[model samples]
Target chain A: MAFGEFDLIETYFTHRLPQRDDVTVGIGDDGAVASVPEKSDLVVVTDTMVQGVHFDQDTPARAIGHKIVAVNLSDLAAMGAEPAWISLALTLPEINDEWLTGFAHGLREICEYYNCQLIGGDTTQGPLSITVTAHGFVPNGKAIRRSGAKPGDWLYVSGTLGDAGLALAARQHRQKLNPDYERRLTERLYFPSARVALGQSLRGIASSAIDVSDGLLADVGHILKASHVGARISVDELPLSLAVTESLSAEQAITYALTSGDDYELLFTVPEAQRGLFDTVTAHSPSKPVCIGRITNEPELVQLRFGDEAWELPEGLAGFEHFRKTELSQ
Target chain B: MAFGEFDLIETYFTHRLPQRDDVTVGIGDDGAVASVPEKSDLVVVTDTMVQGVHFDQDTPARAIGHKIVAVNLSDLAAMGAEPAWISLALTLPEINDEWLTGFAHGLREICEYYNCQLIGGDTTQGPLSITVTAHGFVPNGKAIRRSGAKPGDWLYVSGTLGDAGLALAARQHRQKLNPDYERRLTERLYFPSARVALGQSLRGIASSAIDVSDGLLADVGHILKASHVGARISVDELPLSLAVTESLSAEQAITYALTSGDDYELLFTVPEAQRGLFDTVTAHSPSKPVCIGRITNEPELVQLRFGDEAWELPEGLAGFEHFRKTELSQ
Candidate 1:
């Protein structure tokens, strides 16, 4: 039996995802209602994933659902916002009951874990794509931004970088690695955990912050441009996982750390005065935050240090420009 | 010169759109904020338009922008919500400055008229598509719904319906009309206005309501299914413009009026006590509302009257279905 739009919404979308008290109104209505506590502002972000561009057509429905939400949630985490509600716009070639079931299950699992509600969305027919708009709330003026880093502020990055990029390389069979290493890398690429709690805890604490979606060097360049400051990063301090280190040479790992993207880890800066507090916070974290660099007085210049030797990074740093052509050509 | 993401956003999207005081945060953040007045529930609706599926490549960018936002706003009007804020996800083939400027201008025009804020959004590269998520607010439980009609309620429709269908027929060269009539039909096809004010006024007045995006017969069928009732509609009472009547034969015009989509007018049911209020409200509207039908005790059946003759409408009503076979072959 073919289901109409209304029937599809009621059966699969309404009340299927997790519910939260903060959501005043949910699916089945014109829109949804979410509360922003007094003295706080809501943080919202939207991201769309197209079939061929973002993922392969054969990619599982569950992974597609999980990845789209994770990416938008990562933006909220970067802003130190507590996620509350999400709306999804799903465009598909056709409605397949099995695919919808798997997708909803994946979405529901994540919503439950994050305490967010799947409030409302529109489903249409088209080339397969999913757009998720997520909402989070933070105390007024407390949300972190890419600006505010001053000279001498220490730069820190939580967890490792480039694992996701490495995974992508392995998935496309562009590079070969040990079976275990490839599996680990692919897992990171498919299901990255957004650091929401860590970001919230760092509220009123970090001087500047951004999520590492692009490469470490390129994303940090954004902070430099926004804050009107430069940085000197220590090459040795980059946190590479044992799996990554064992799978690739030191030079290759260094290149990946600087240029590979899709890590979803938080990169932040802290003042010298709060060094002790930073230490305390890092000590309790599952992965310790590494001080990889220090902000400089100079503008529009980033330098790298390898022990006593120093090298100037190139100007016009290239990152993942969503629509622009990259060096990795077909 | 090729522009970076930030430069593109600042140059094209930032100040080019409408401004409103309800916007607590506009652009340039993880998310944007808009205030919802106390005792109101926020309504959100999202819709996506893909290049080949929704529009042709030759269609102007301005029309694409207008249609994306307009379709979503129509959903808000159906629920009697006040338009307040919107976020856009634009996936383009490439970043063309001229196209972006035209599109933004069209979007800005609608936002300014509706008192809505153009908040944050995401931009990416893919096959050209645009997704807009609109938000509005209404007093708690005051918004009209699809499932609220009673057996004795009077059914009414606003404005003319068949012009858009006539426009489509002209586009396909199946029918030809005078230039003046063609212009009117095309305008109705491309820029149909959402009856937000009419819907808001019908908040408590309309027991059940829906916007006629689908043809009259199909959309009314939705109301019947939702409200668990039937409807008796008069074919002659459907408001058709002289342009439509002159462009097509009487039988063809009646079919177009019954099955034409893209008329973003309200189709609603009101109790007998509120019948007098329609006259007061219609006096203020540019297009008058006309009573055309009555809700019936029978379930899942819709009948139409033409003078002394009555006929049962077919089981498959005309409307856009995402998964249905295309009518292009016909």
Candidate 2:
């Protein structure tokens, strides 16, 4: 049976998502009321996932819910903000009980794990799209930004990249893979983790930071543009796992690491002075940050170097352009 | 020429919109940060407008932009929040420079008037849709909610309603019009003024409150549902202009007042003790708040009375359900 908008919200959203004490008002109100703790600033981020653009109809509802919310949380993590409350604006083609249940279940699981509260949201009838506006808190003057990197800053990236890209390339293709590697790559695609803890820990330590939503090269280029500095990245120094190495050639893997989007990994810059603290910081953490390159005094140039061979690349660039390219044919 | 998302953002959105000091971090970041003044709580609301569902393709880009932002501000006004910052997620069929320029201009005008900063947002390619998440600040514990009305509380509404409905109905026909009446009705449809000032003034005084978005009958029903109270409204007591009276029969006007959506006026309740305060509060306001009904102890019944006749009405009812019958026919 077709459901009205209000009824749909009541059934799919209201009580299904995790709630928190900080949310004084929840669903069914004109707007949600949330209380940010004293001495903390609120970080608000909104991202919209559209059908055919962000995801296809055949994608599982649970995975769509997880990825949408995960991508939003990644923004907060990039700013060194702790996830607090989120409001969802979901527009659906039609109400499907099973789909709603799976979507809410997936959303709830992540909120529970992340300690983020689902405060309030709106549900309407339209093309299937999910717009999540998440709120996070950061200590005063502690939130990281992309404009803080200096010439001598060391660039670091957390975890292996390009696996998610590779998984996407092979999602429809029947490619043989080792069970462990296949699972790892698929998890990277469907259940990508936001580096919240790692980002929060780097609050006062990292000079500049960004989340890898667009490919590493493009996203890091944002830092270079904002920071007004050049960067030299060594393709050989790029991080890759055995799964990634086994799945793709070294050159292909490097390309994915540099240009594949949706990694959700934290890329940051640390001053040379704090370079020694890297081992100390990683010893206490579950994952270590890998140093990939160094910032340069030269302006508007990003070069790649491999021992005796050096190549001049795109100027001050990295990442995918949403409207520029149709596909990665190269 | 192909444009990178970053370049498109810098070229079009970065400094094109208004800015306010309340925004700590504006666009070009992982998230936007706005400061909530001491002793105040943040009020947030979101609204999504889809192309085919909310507005027609021929609808002016400027009007669409204004309506999208206005509707969200209306929600904040219902809660007595001062509009502060708005983050937009705009999904478009393509980058039409003329449309973007017009839309941004319209949005900028409202932002300037409301003193709201255009913070971080996303621009992506998709079927045309704009999702706006607006934030405001309210004094702690002063936000008027729908759950505060008591049995003896008197129901009131600011300004006349139903003009928007009439305008929508007559938009395509464009039959000969009374110029004055046409101006007023079209204003109701195209440029609704959210009762922000009045709602704020009633924060401490109003027992319950809501914005007339879906229609008076339906929106007030939300308050009834939340407060667990019933109401008795007099059809003859509904405020109406001479234009509306001349344009339609008394019964039709009453029905429009009750069920016509898009008025964006405030409907609120005040206790008997505050009856004397109404004149004083509304004396300087542009629109007078007129008392039309009273709350009852009954559980789930809303009744309408006209002279000696009394008719039972739907409980917790409002106007124009997304999947329900369209108001245009009635």
Candidate 3:
């Protein structure tokens, strides 16, 4: 029997998912209703992934579904909020049972891991695209903001950078790697983890936070723009995975780390007063936080250094622009 | 002077929108943070409009923008929630300044009227589609659900129905309408009002409620299925606008009202004990509520009546199925 839109939803999304206690009303309602705990603020974020634009056919359906949820949760993570509920607006060109099953599996896996619930959504027939709106919660006046970084704050990033980009490069045949490294890099690309726990731990310790989705330099620029402060990054201190460092030359690896997007790591800052608490908290983290830079008194000027020498980004390395025909853009 | 995604957002969407007092963090952040009232539940509804599926080129950009927000708000209305904030995930085929301007204008117009704020959103390069996730608030335990109706409840509908469907038929040239009626019908189709005020007024009185987007019969079926009860619709009492009544034969108008979608009127039920109170409350409402039917003890059976005579739906009239090749499917 051919599945209509309603049947597809019933078969895949409407059942067998994580159910949260806060969700007063879940699926099969005009709208989902949820209770926000008293003295807690609601954090909302939305992201869209288009078929050919965000992911090619080479990207697995499960990975596409996983990446969409991960990206939005990464935003919530950046805000130091506890992931709560999500709503999906899924548009499909056609109904393929295998693809839907795989996609639902991936979506449910991430939601389960984060203890988030799929509260409600709309599934319609259209181009293959998924838009996820994720909601999280943080205690009142405690939600992290990009503008909270002070000039004297020490900047840190959770997890390694550039592996996702390097994976993309290998997939596009712009780079080559050993089979083991290729598998590891591809895994990083397909299953990027949002630093939810680390972000929550940084709530009181970190001065500001942002997820590294638009490359390290561009995302840091966002912080500087919002906070009205500048930073000096020690390029030598940038954390790179063994896969990226082994597969590319030093300059190429650094460039990838600085300019590549889709690394869902938290780039954050800790003030001098909170550095001790930050270190103590991160010591228990699975991914060690690396302090690579410091916020500066200089306004809107980002200085880069290698050891004692001032450095510049390699020529022709640019940030991702979605509307432009950029080679590395997603 | 080409527009990048960031530039496009900054130019058209970032500024000049309504600001809500509860919005602690708005656009220009990884996520938006808002304070939900301590005693209220958060209501969320998402809807997507895809090009060539939900709308065509002839549909104005302004109407498209207005309708997307309106549809989601209608869902929130059905739940007896007050519209609050919205996040948009807009995928555009290309960046057209004029289209963006008109779309933003319509969006802002409705948002301003409803006192809803445009929170953070994501804009990407892809096919022309708009997915809006709207958030609202309702007092705890007061949200009207579709499953709350009891047997013998009086079913009521807000405003006239079938005008939007007639407008669509006229636009498709399947039927012709007088110029004056055509203008009125198309206006109904493009700029349908979600009964926000009236829905809020039904908070304690409505036993069950749903928005009539998928025609009368289909939506009534939704309420019946959820409530686990049957319904008997008095076809003679189905509300029809003058534009719909005058342009089509009686049977055709009824068919349009039963099978046509996108009217966005409220279909709700009030228990027998609440009739006197319901009438007293609705007396001050802007739109006169009309009694159309009653709930029955029979399960899952929807009986139609035309003044004392049993009636059946005409042949070839099917409900809108998004994935099916139905003639009137959206």
TM-score of predicted structure 1: 0.90
lDDT of each: 0.78, 0.79, 0.87
Candidate 3 deviant stretches above 4 angstroms: A1-5, A318-330, B1-5, B318-330
* Model 3 residue B158 distance off true place after TM-score fit, in angstroms: 0.9
C-alpha RMSD in Å of predicted model 2 compared with the true structure: 3.9
lDDT of 2 by residue, B1-330 (tens): 112455556666676567777677888888887678888888888888888777778878887778888888999989988988988888877878889887877787787788888787777777788888999888888888999999999999998888887777677673334466887787678777878788888878888899998888878888988899999888788888766777887777787788878888999999999877866887888878788899998854688898668943344343334324442111
Ranking by TM-score: 3, 2, 1
Candidate 2 on A1-330: residue-level lDDT in tens?
112545666766667466777777877778888888888888988788888876678777887888878988999999999999888888877767788888887787888899887777777667888889999999877888889999988989998888787777777574444456887887888888888888888888899899998878878888998899989887788888787788777766777788878888999999978766766776676557788888998774777876557843234433334222443111
lDDT score for candidate 2 against the true structure: 0.79
Interface RMSD of each: 5.6, 5.2, 4.7
CA lDDT of B210 in candidate 3? Answer: 97
Every model's DockQ, to 2 decimals? 0.38, 0.48, 0.57
Worst lDDT window (10 residues) for model 2 chain B? B321-330
DockQ: the better of candidates 2 and 3 = 3
Native interface contact recovery, model 1: 0.40
lDDT of 1 at B130: 82
Please give, as one word, the docking class of candidate 2: acceptable
Candidate 1: give the clashing pairs. Answer: A31-B43, A31-B44, A44-B31
The positional error of residue B135 in candidate 1, measured at the CA in angstroms, is 1.5
